[model samples]
Target: MAKGKVGKTVGSLGDYLKEQRVGARLSLRQLADQAGVSNPYLSQIERGLRKPSAEVLQQIAKALRISAEQLYIRAGILSPDDGVGGSVELAILSDTGLTERQKQSLLDVYASFLALNAADGADDATPAGAENDAEGTAPITTEIDPDSDNRVTNEG
Candidate 1:
């Protein structure tokens, strides 16, 4: 069978790899260990100083716990749907070392942070209420139910 053509785009593969690595908050050494590749080699690949073979890409995808197709698409080796937006956050959450439960936990924390920030912003935008305590602080209490998912039960 004829070999498929690889992308000649400048730094496309390297950029993709680097982005994925950073998104996962992984160091070069960690990715190297997981991918069974040397740290120097992965570094060179991320710098566009080296080209990796298809077998190496497969290993990387396995280590990253993502589909080979996704890696191929990122590497410019395959074309996939461009309709769905790609998320660096999601890529990070997909790391092999992370369990589904851990990812959910991280997502829940992030959501709560966002909610708190939004609430603060809203308070700042509104006029001061007479109910403001002696410290002139708006009391917002977040209650978390152990049985429930990260949905906040507002005690306000």
Candidate 2:
């Protein structure tokens, strides 16, 4: 990475960091303290005079209560595709109640479910009617029995 404020990407990253800090209503000194960085260094980063490392970016993201992946994308450490995840992933990542390990586990499970669904979709390329009409295939149907405590009952 180029140093000394010449890089446009670095400037944009710095601009984004400043925007986030301001949006969080944090002073430069306060943000620096929360991010465990020096005020001068943080100011230099905001001014595009220096490009921060991924670790520093993560600290800043935590301080700003934002996604570290967003910071990584802004800093050119991760591509948009690499950081791509919908609201569920964002919620999981942003949930402060979960430990890092628990968050990672949940994310892993969610990714696996997505992959499984995608594979199933790919395998459904046959003619639409043929899918359910194939031999040994049955469409499972469920109904909530009013008589029973709303328990789901499998019909076919």
Over 1-156, each residue of candidate 2 has an lDDT whose tens digit, in order, gives: 455434777789889999989999999999999999999999999988887865677789999999898886676544476335456765766677987678668877987887887797798866555756577566666777878757685635
Model 1, TM vs. native: 0.43
lDDT on C-alpha atoms for all candidate structures: 0.67, 0.78
**Residue 80, candidate 2: C-alpha displacement in angstroms:** 0.6
| Cα displacement (Å) at residue 23, model 2 | 1.1
State the TM-score for model 2.
0.50
lDDT of 1 by residue, 77-102 (tens): 33354334335334535466876567
> Which ranges in model 1 have alpha carbons more than 4 Å from their true place?
1-10, 80-156
Among these predictions, the greatest TM-score belongs to: 2
- Give per-model TM-scores: 0.43, 0.50
